[model samples]
Target chain A: MINDNSEIILSVRDLRATVDGTEILKGLNLEVRAGEIHAIMGLNGSGKSTFSKVLAGHPDYEVTAGEIHFKGQDVLELDPHDRATAGIFLAFQYPLEIPGVSNRDFLRVAFNAHRKARGEDEIDVFDFDDLIEEKLDVVKMDASFLDRSVNEGFSGGEKKRNEILQMALLEPALSILDETDSGLDIDALKTVAGGVNQLANADNAVVLITHYQRLLDYIVPDFVHVMADGRIITTGGKDLAKQLESRGYEWVLEEFRAGVTA
Target chain B: MATVSDVSVLRTADQRDAYLKGLVQIAQAAVPENLALEEVRSRAASFLNEQTFPSTRQEDWRFTDLSAMLAIDFATTGEASVTEADIAELRLPETAGAQVVVVNGRVSRELSQLGSLPEGAVVGSLGDRPELQSQLADRLAQASGNHEVFTALNTVGFTDAVVVWLPRNQVVETPIQIIYVSQAQGDSLLVQPRCLVVAESGSALTLVEDYWGNSTATHFTNAVTELWLDANAQITHSRIEREGTGTFHIGKTVVTQARDSQYIGVAAGFGAKLARHNWEIYQTGEQTTTRIYGLGAISATQHADTHSLVALSHPHGIVEQEHKAIVDGKAHSVFNGRMAVAQKAQLTNASQLNRNLLLSDQARIDTKPQLEIVADNVKCAHGATVSQLQSDEIFYLQSRGISAPQAQRLLIYAFAMEILDRIPVETLRSRLAEAITQWP
Candidate 1:
């Protein structure tokens, strides 16, 4: 029940997804083993977000046909909340604004749900307060944030930091940071990356779905994958991210086209 | 009594006479021999004679259509006895402090629980208390400027109503709950119930009114509640209207807050065939604050009108009002809220907002939020919005694996959360949420 296997934490084969009846991801395949950080980079509309959303089981996108395995269990049948409770955390690119639920209450509910799903005893309120206090130090979040509504009027950097704070609380096996670095300044990015790094361990894997390579400079990745037209076109070591950063996505497309023509 | 009754325009006139005649009879039987209530009774009688029931011609009564109530040949459902079933249904968890049961406009002592009160705390029917007549008797029938004929009617026709008094430095820990239940059977039954609450200096108390009815017989309910909070006094009041079908109900409440006093009014309108509630709050003293939050869910062919007007007549006064409604089927709902700040009411801060959700194509909602400021230093703002659910929000929720209906429900709940979350009482908020969730 704890997913003790040391093999792959997540596997995807020929994942095709559609949003609002428009096909976004044609065919995508990737595998992530334990203790690895993967960075995905591509141009806008290249299906980077679609892949992350499909994995997280977002409601609007329907999979015509695909195979996704999380800890050797089928994940396509799970709901978003279920996926979240099943050791899969998705840091939304734009977190929802829930006006009445406080940040502390939301974190507590999410944390306890995952713990219960893992067959562990639910965290007591006192223990939760202690645990959350410790995690807040990693993000440098003030205590006032615990009383405010969930992401209501939160700044871009604060929202991203809150995401990492939640990640520290949930401790998921395969955490997907969906463009978590979009709205952060350099200092905020460093602080957020530091929180993420502290949560990274041998038992879990991280997927950094991003467009810029700047975030990769802070949170170094083991593998870099290039997605084009809803499919993963190229995969390489961390050097690939640097190469893409200098040459842009058009260079890789030109090289691929040249290979096809030849 | 008038000599001749030409039934044409004399319908309201004759009704007024009959109402006064019944009140006089009840006063003779119920009031104590030594209580000097003749002046209060005469003033109410004269006020009733000068006022006329509002018709469709008046803008405030345009959508209400009280013609059915005016034309109904109804007799007063007076001195009705409460059955065991009626007593059994008068139970509410938060009403453990002091309870008063009014059946068909008459107080039932056997069904009430008048809990122990602090020194100088008084709880009895307004008509039964001749001592209070010396102070609040004249202000009870003062002109409200607006043509609220029902309030005048209630003032004249009220047979039995509760009057609560909290003296200086006394705090009533338990909320005094007045349960108004309509058990009148058959058609053409009418009832006018009145309730008054007065909290003196440095006193703190809470009052709750739970209104309901059994029989579906066609009837009219003219109800009024007057609240007066003296200097440094605090009052929290909540009312629930669960009237049955085939009932034409009108409720008017006037709350005047004094210096450094705090008053909060929360109302939930759940069931009514045609119901209208008028809430008027006037801050007559400096540093007073009043907050009113209301929720209404009307469906089918029913009609509900909820109007709130708050006036800051003194400097450093504050008023906050928010109302939300969910209208479905062919029902029509109206919310009119206005905040007025007088010239001398500088440093006043007032805000009003009305938000509505139209669930069906045929459902209609009319909301008007206004702020009239004569003071240059006051801060005032008002806004009203009427719209259906957003498709993108719905799709977003659905994409998260929530079903269509469930997603809509959550969005509706989110829309109403602004007011629901503001409620100070947690259990009542949850109960209100449960009621909204179970809406058919």
Candidate 2:
């Protein structure tokens, strides 16, 4: 139902960010349209994770020069929590383990926070129980996981699944998955990717930041952008991922350098 | 161990001399006469006359300075007149139990509820009960020796006491609640409340003690509680102190456990301008278990200290102690935990942990965990940690749509839940959680 004519959900132009006085993101440009799955592939230390953190308004990452507009509002002025309530969700690669806090309680607070931000009535505990029960099925998680502390002693795959579970509950307009497939096994990868594919629709967009091409095999991307040296060097269709997978990034780097000099 | 010259120098005009003078005046006016505890009280009074208040030079009183408390000239007074309506307002909401009210160091019989208790269990004023003379003479002041000046002072000046006695093989289904309320009429007042709990062999009891007072007046609450558990006896003791911010509170709890006995203590300190609690436990017989968990939250120029000592003189004893303090604003928290295992106490397992969370840059925490094991076969471990809120943890919660303040509160509650969850009473646990959430 969605095509290139769909509305733009996120737009970033000439973004420059620094952490601890060291610049990581330099003059980066990106745009995400509604209903499209965009995959950003890059080598190590290519500012892939920094971009996601900057969009989420992490306090440590300072935006030196950039313009970020989310849903027609300047996102740079909003706090991280405000960004989240405004329908932006970031799935962390390494989820924090908060001991003594039940996962169900955490989910309830997060769900109600988004609803309250939209001027809607907050659901009670009983209604929330029923609502969260349905969201658990999206990630194929057992109901018993709700009773334990949030990621206190969960396995690698379980943490990732919990992240996706939260994304499902918030129902964000733009969801960014940052290396969510790194620590997972083949079975867990299929489950998480399947969950993401099911949640993607004509109204919401998803951005996958990964280093490997195997994830594309499960949830095909509408566009693949290869990033190097803090900027996107090339953009192509789905075949570009295959080409990079078979030939590696060395040829792409050499061609980019040659083009830059010419 | 002072020389004649040093003694003469100390005998000159000083803060200790001022306190000694005040103690004499109070003893002359406040000491009750011709009771069953006459000899015990006399001996404690003599000990108090010879001793002086501890200064910062002493090891135990190093971190907790009493200069400000000592500066105030407090008067020891009898019971303050309080109406039934006043007592009703201080009762815990939705609580079902046998409640005992103590106002200004005297037990209020009309306000106490004793009909719910079993026949064998006794909950009455120490001044009215002459039948418990022998039991009081034997167990009173047994755990806390004359070394600590404050405990000795409490024994000397206490007008009346509350006794909760469970006879042999008796088990009480409901918890016994003791509420101590302090009120000042005009001047700065001092109140000393004494509690004695004796659990006979094969008996079980759960006791809750609450300390609260008026917020408009300046007062000092000095309390002492002695617990004696016979063989195979079990007792769960919970003490909650939430006095006014203008008040000074100093409390001491001494527990003695016999063979096959179990003792669990949950102590929370959340009030007072200067609050200090000293917990001392003595293991007399083998195969005894002791668990002590404490939480202290102080803010806005308040100072709170918890000092605990567990001595294992018997074999096959187990002890676990965990104490945490959350300090904000300009408050200061201090914890000193000591575990001593004797040579005869083989196969003893003991562990002590002290964790503190500082919420402000100006807040401070001093934690010292000491473990002494004379037996080679004993397993004893101790740890202490002080940290601020992790930025990443806060950010992680914020990224989930939770605001910064909500995230910090959730993290703090979670940090305290480690000990709060172990409380047996459901209402008290939730009440403490609510207090933690509402703390500024």
Candidate 3:
């Protein structure tokens, strides 16, 4: 049921990736287009997180065989930073605590890198202060957060909010949220989901990777895919998430196996 | 009878000859008419004659080899003419203070600007102020004894000394800046720069010592600084050493704190082919506070060594020390920090930490943090860590659109900023930040 006219922001074909000689994403295929939000739900060790890391070209994961194209260009050949400047963003589940680097300086460097890649004028300190102040409101963060080190000594909820703050500043075309709601409470989840909904538009897309279907309740997805054994065995509408939440993944896996045998 | 190899015999012979030649030249030079000064010089010369340049055979010199330094045929002449223009570019920007310029170990009155100081405050060359001879003679060689070869050499060969003295109950509003610029006029010139700072009881002072050199010449800077803080005196000392890439530098700083005194030392080493700094602090009286912080950034085959010791001899003394090194390329960095609490120093609290970051595969770091507590009721802790940059940290930054090099630079800057941020002066902090960010 994919739209024909919508732009194909990301396309994956028979992707295979491994970490330390152990295969993680085995024969996975997914296509994401503009104006669509896709959700990937799986149990533990089901390769849901591995898929997002592979998409970001993480050094620990090696792409044994895959073809990934983003906006009509090969993305697998790009470095992680080049992929980022090419408008791909991955919100980490656990943000690193970088001591001594101020949050303001870190954000400015990230923003300037993207601007420089796009041949735009770099923003100075005064201008950046003004710019980041506006973006901080998206996550309901205080200005004092900018003075402290990046994610250092921050609570889990604050760290997630910071991830969303960076996402707002970068404004990538394709955003991958890998378990961004796991440690967040209901209130933080709502705020983060609201920010994501506002940032999403017809010209951009999102891929939410999560273990629970609760996050999809706040931000409804255009498509829901069930990943099992490093591959998506079934795909459906928003109702699939409701059914999986009420029941469990066992029935779905049983039906997929039956269908394969028949 | 001794089975000394030809190479060892030749090296010992060269070192002995250099010592004798240096002593003769220093003795033949113009001497101060003061008897105490003459005795100090003669005692230092005899000490130098009894000792030789230490090699890797010594425990303190195990990680640091002085063969390259001793191999050079050093010039004994102390006279090197330097104009105001020669030192114009070496001054710190946006720093307003009383300036004392020392060129080739000789204080330059033409280049010095002894601005109006507080009452009872004196800032000038020791030769100019013969009235302060008693103060100099009492504290000149008190901190650094003649046991060390480098300190003894500085004590013997120093042409003139920069003295910053504050009488009782006097406070200097502005920091006193001492700039030592080494400009070599010939091959392998030796310049001994000496400074003596005496802060009387109930006085306060902030001192900044900046050392730089002409990058085109090969020289040796043997520098010594003695700081004596009387009861209730407080002093902040900052030493910034950025010498020429082909130069050899050995600096000794000895601090003595009396009862209820406070001493803080912040040092940064960035430039030199081979550099070594020895800092020793003695808490002579009760209830003294001592803090020492040091940072060294070396790259491209440069070697830097920092050895610091804090001794608490009286009761209720406190000390906190931290030294960090960032080594890149084939550079080498060594840090040795020692905290000693004597038997009489009950309730003494001391902590020492040495952290090193190696940026390249071939980069090397040797860190040792030592604590020896003889008192039963003392608290002492020491730790050291040597690590390389984590790849995951770099990737995390890269995921945010920062290039790899930019991410590495930011991380390294953050690592160094921990020490640089502690500097109270904003101008000095920013200048050092820029230097570390642009470092290879």
CAPRI classification of candidate 2: high
Q: lDDT by residue for model 1 over A1-262, one digit each (tens)?
A: 1233556999999988898999998878999988889999899989998888788776678998889999999989976666777778878788777665577766776676667667889899889988999999999999899989878899999888888888887778889999999978999999999988888888899999999999999999988999888988888888999998888889888876787699
TM-score of the first chain alone, every candidate: 0.95, 0.98, 0.98
Put the candidates in lDDT order, highest first.
Answer: 2, 3, 1
Cα lDDT tens digits, model 3, A42-113, are 889989999998888789999999799999899888999999999999999998999989999999999999
Worst 10 residues of 3 chain B by lDDT: B27-36
Candidate 3 error regions (>4 Å): A1-4, B1-36, B144-146
lDDT of 2 by residue, A92-183 (tens): 98999999899999999999999999999999999999999999999999999999999999999999999999999999999999999997
Give the C-alpha interface root-mean-square deviation per candidate. 4.7, 0.5, 0.6
DockQ of each candidate, alpha-carbon based: 0.16, 0.87, 0.84
Ranking by DockQ: 2, 3, 1
Tens-digit per-residue lDDT, B277-344, candidate 2: 99999899998999999999889899999999998999999999999999999999999998889998
Q: Candidate 3's residue-wise lDDT over B1-440, tens digit each?
A: 55569777777768766765664465336344542387777787787767766778788999998777655667756457788788776555434548899988878888888765766788889878777877677788767444688887777667788998899989886878899999866778777889999999989988889898757577888899999999999999889999999888999999989999999899999988889999999888999999889999999999999999888889999898889999999999998888888999999988888889998999999888777888999888888889888888888899999988889999999999988887766677888899888886
Better of 2 and 3 by lDDT: 2
The best candidate in terms of lDDT: 2
